[model samples]
Target: MEEHNIFSLIADNLSQFYEYTGFANATFGHILMILIGLAFVYLAIKKEWEPMLLVPIGFGIIIGNIPLFPGLSVGVYEEGSVLNILYQGVQQGYYPPLIFLGIGAMTDFSALISNPKLMLIGAAAQFGIFGAYGIALALGFTPAEAGAIGIIGGADGPTAIFLSSRLAPDLVGAIAVSAYSYMALVPVIQPPIMRLLTTKKERLIKMKSPRAVSKKEKIMFPIIGFLLTAFIVPSGLPLLGMLFFGNLLKESGVTRRLAETARGPLIDTVTILIGLTVGCSTQADKFLQWTSIKIFILGFLSFVIATAAGVLFVKFFNLFLKKGNKINPLIGNAGVSAVPDSARISNNIGLEYDKTNYLLMHAMGPNVAGVIGSAVAAGILLGFLS
Candidate 1:
């Protein structure tokens, strides 16, 4: 009888231990999310698609999906967990402005400054955000959630995150992932649209070289840009302020050290933390919903709309410009603010059509403008909705 009781106690303990194991707690959603994470890793390593962003985010997805026994403090969402603490950077919108500072430090506004008309292309691309806003509303999301989702169309991840965090904190994970995913896929997505939107002659067209911008212009742009933009939509100051500040640090020449730190170590550290935490926030229960699917679809639609709007708008704008000054429609795709990626696509596709037509510098004008335009749009949305 004593031996049997001891055996029964041991069996009970073993059963309880098994209950705490991942296999016991795991669900179909967890497995699905893990597979998606692995796919992201594979794409990063094998395809070299946005490796910096995808690798950290992919690994984070795996970490987040690992089934946990209830009450464990190891998960990202569990209060007092290390991951939870680290996640505050994303949750509270601290990482985006820091990243913007890095971008400003790294960027050269000379392209945009040399040709101010390109700024209009950037502004036109924002049609995607508002277009998506209407669609999201039709789909039944609240004004705030729709506003957050719409920012994904800008193809600027940090802006998407910043806007979503303010407007719809609950949907931040889906919106952030959607924004970054599309940004990373710019090479794949923009080319076909660029080809479809314009004729062969339009793709081959090349404009005159940009005028050289002086040191005074470079140094003054950030200050003037900040005042002009921030004064218009002061709510965007968090992102726009950091962006312009970083630019000033770089262009000021006196602050090379500060610019280097902001563009290099500081940005790298913040990127890893932001990417990982954002990935972790997409726990199966939270991310695998029908709403997430809807967000992804809307995100794709928004990106497509933004790209088309830019290209089509250029075609319309060309009617007003004289020959030799008419912009290459290929560069219009750069208006979505994927930075050098979208600009590079513009250059590469133009190269495919005509080797002599180099559009990189021209494309950079609208590419960088897209960044500013997106931030401004986010501020406007936040002001009205939040």
Candidate 2:
């Protein structure tokens, strides 16, 4: 009886150990991932790198690391699990599209419509996306994975999310965080590249005052932009469609209530969910890889390339334009889609050169264009990969 009892006890202990350790043994890789996730949270809160995004991401990383938590186990796609639920929305490309509705409602396209030429600058800046894709491919990523990583150069969070979700869902978390992180750091990341690429004289080059756009033109803008974008890049429909639709609501004048809902309640709720889910996906095992480091490095390089491209494009355009019609090269940095923040930074820098030089309106032209360019690049990648 005593011998039989000892065998039963040993069997029970072995079962418990196996259950706790998961399929593979608990290893250093797991520990490293948890630390990296914590580091992301610290950066989000302490350094204030898009706190709205980083905080949730940080928390999610912690939660995701609680080993053997049944429904929260890593890579398990079973229903009722935390990751499974979030992964569903990410894999299906649902969250980003919804988020775009809010972004569209909030975007103001008046500046871009007034100066259609600036649209070319926005298009020029997307060279970074392709540039990064080529580099990532060389670094050994499959074409689909490289495409997802390259979209980070667009500096457009939702577009990055959308493309990653579709082409490389496994990398959605890292790519999204890197895209938003660099975007929030635009005030820091873009200025050095801008200054290096432009002479102080060029930064002070005052641009022509923009002509006032009519309400009718504003209303027609979204419609025309959407049609052109959709016709050109059907893969971009998910992003461009939501963006233009939001713009339509803002410009239409008839959908004031709808616009308010999109801008306010809709954006707030989606941001919370999106941020949390994004954070949750950054578990230790997945995030602590050598590839994550490469993604971060590539993302920063892409931003630098995009900034340089925008500045060079402006200089090239100046060579052809009449002297008085030239744009301040400083505004070219705003071609990154960091929203009004990038535009505002350009205006502030221009003010330092010439106090009366208000580059905000001019900067906005390229800023909005960057949004479209990123989506178009995403579309092209999806075309090739999807």
Candidate 3:
């Protein structure tokens, strides 16, 4: 009787240890995931690859890979766990919308409105999105998965997240990381392609000064544009509405305090949350797949194709216009959704050609339009997949 009692006690303790540690059952794949998460952190801190996002994502990846890491027993939340709470917001699709609001507050639409024709450059750049989607489909991804992957070409983080949430939630973290990573690397990615596509004469081509914009036009622009966009692509309302609303606040004289807050404190706070939440989604199990590698490769290719497409389209547009009205092909590269960074690069390259040339304002036309184009592309993907 005594021996039997001791044996039963040992068995109970062994079972409890296995339940608590999870190492009693962890596999090789699980260990590989932890290493990948650490690699992301190393790259973020050491290589500085979008450190804002990579740091948090790396931490999240680590936390997520721990076996039985408290409430992850069945591969999901069971309440009272840190990941459970964070995971809820992502699953509910909350972060992307809030992030959109912050993005709107940060954007300046003056350039886009002053030069509506540049909107076409933004539209032309989206060829990469469709082109990538076709390639992804060819690679054997389902339509929904390919759509999520293709938005990487847009180079817009929030739009990618929004599309991924609806189309391919499983690939969201990888897609978002890839999108932002390429956007940050725009300077490196774009110039080589631009140089290859345009000759010195094209690069040196002088562009006319953009027409002056009026305050009244600025105030009315967001409203009219929002209405047009909402009517035409209701699916884009979440992104476009927030963006235009932010712009309205900036342009409206009465909303100085609100605009200041949106551009400053509000965006800062949300960026922290957005960064951390995005990072947390990079758990090894989800991130280290063969598909994840393919997504990154596809995203990089999409960006290259988009850049090439934009430059070629602008050159094509130049053929139809009078000489003085011709646009600098460098500005065409800004049509991809890298925002101010790509636009700044365009301005820099223009200065390289002619010290007096200022392509910043001109480049912004396509830069802002790229935002709308990305949202539209995302909407199209959602339409097809959802």
Candidate 4:
């Protein structure tokens, strides 16, 4: 009886050990995703590519992929899990509006107001969204999925997340990651396209300074922009509304405290939560599909197309302009919704040809316009697809 009891105890201990070992149930997919997560962390730290977002997202990816025993209620997807609670901000599309509020607070509309015609460049770049939409449709995605995927071309992560959550929840993780990753790579990806399309002369072409924008015009912009955009694309109200509100707070000249909070702490906190939740959403089993791969490919192509469209639009504009008044096509690349990074890239590349030509302020005109254009494009897609 003693020997039998010893054997029973040994067997029970082994069984418990086996039960606790995550490696026992871990699949190849989990390992692959974990490695990919580590790669994101490496890029964040070593390359310093959007570190604030990439680091949290990378770590969250690792957290999401850790194998858990069956029926555990603590996983990100588990109904009652803490991660699941955090993830609700993503699933219900809460984070994007808050993020837009922050963006609006921080953004300066002076550049855009100074050169209102450059707004056309931003609108023209949105061609990428429709282009990707058609491609996704050809590739067999549903209208809703295609619409969500198309937003990736806008190079706007928050907008992508918001659209995906509304139209294709299954793809939120993939779309969000693709949009952000591409946005971060704008400095690398956009220059080649900008260079490829423009001649040396076009890049060197210098424009006159933008006209001064009156303070009254500045104050009226948010109100009018919001009203016009909201009435045209009511579906975008959540994002546009918050964006205008935040801008109003900043430009109103009386809400400095609110603007400061929105642009600083509020945005930072929301960015962290958004990044982590989005990363955690990419669980191995869910994310390791052909659809996610397709989304990435389509997203890359969309960005390229958008950049090209902006450049071509500028080149076309030059056909009728006097030499002295000709706009630098290089600034056109900033039409992609990557914001200051795209504008900065345009400035850097322009300097390679002519250091005297300052394109930053000019680029910013289309850069900020791209933000509005992308939001409007998203609203249009949501209207048609949803």
Score candidate 2 by TM-score against the native.
0.89
Candidate that scores best on lDDT? 1
Candidate lDDT scores, in order, read: 0.94, 0.83, 0.81, 0.91
Per-residue CA lDDT of candidate 3, range 1-386, in tens? 99999999999999887877858656676677678668878987887766766677666666666666444533434464555566665656666666666667677777777668899999999988988999999999999999999999998887888888888888887897788778768878998898889888988887777777888998888799889887888888888888888888888878888888877887666666655666666665667789989999999989998998899999999999898889889999888887888888888888887898888988989988998889878877787788
Q: Which ten residues in a row have the lowest lDDT in candidate 3?
A: 69-78
| Per-residue alpha-carbon lDDT of candidate 4 for residues 1-386, written as tens digits (9 for 90 to 100) | 99999999999999988886778778899899889889999999999998888898888898888888856777789998899999999999999999999999999899889878899999999998989999999999999999999999998889999999999999999999899889888988899999999889788888889888887888899999999999999999988998889999999999999999999999999999999999999999999999999999999999999999999999998888787778899988888888789999989998999989889999999999999999999898888888
Sort by TM-score, top down from the best = 1, 4, 2, 3
Colliding pairs, model 3: 57-279
- lDDT value, candidate 1, whole model: 0.94
The whole-model C-alpha lDDT of candidate 3 against the native structure comes to 0.81
Tens-digit lDDT track of model 2 for 1-386: 99999999999999877876645445576566567568878887888777776677666666556555444345434576666777676667888888888888998888888889999889889988889999999999999999999989888887888899989988998898788778878889888888888898898898878889999999998899899999999988988899899989999999999999998999887777777677667666677788989999999989988888888999999999998888888888777787877888888888887889899999999999998888888888999898
Model 2 is weakest, by summed lDDT over 10 consecutive residues, at 69-78
Better of 1 and 2 by lDDT: 1
TM-score of every candidate = 0.97, 0.89, 0.88, 0.96
Name the regions of candidate 3 deviating beyond 4 angstroms.
1-49, 66-80
Regions more than 4 Å wrong, model 2: 1-42, 45-47, 69-78
Pairs of residues at least 3 apart in sequence or in different chains that clash in candidate 1: none
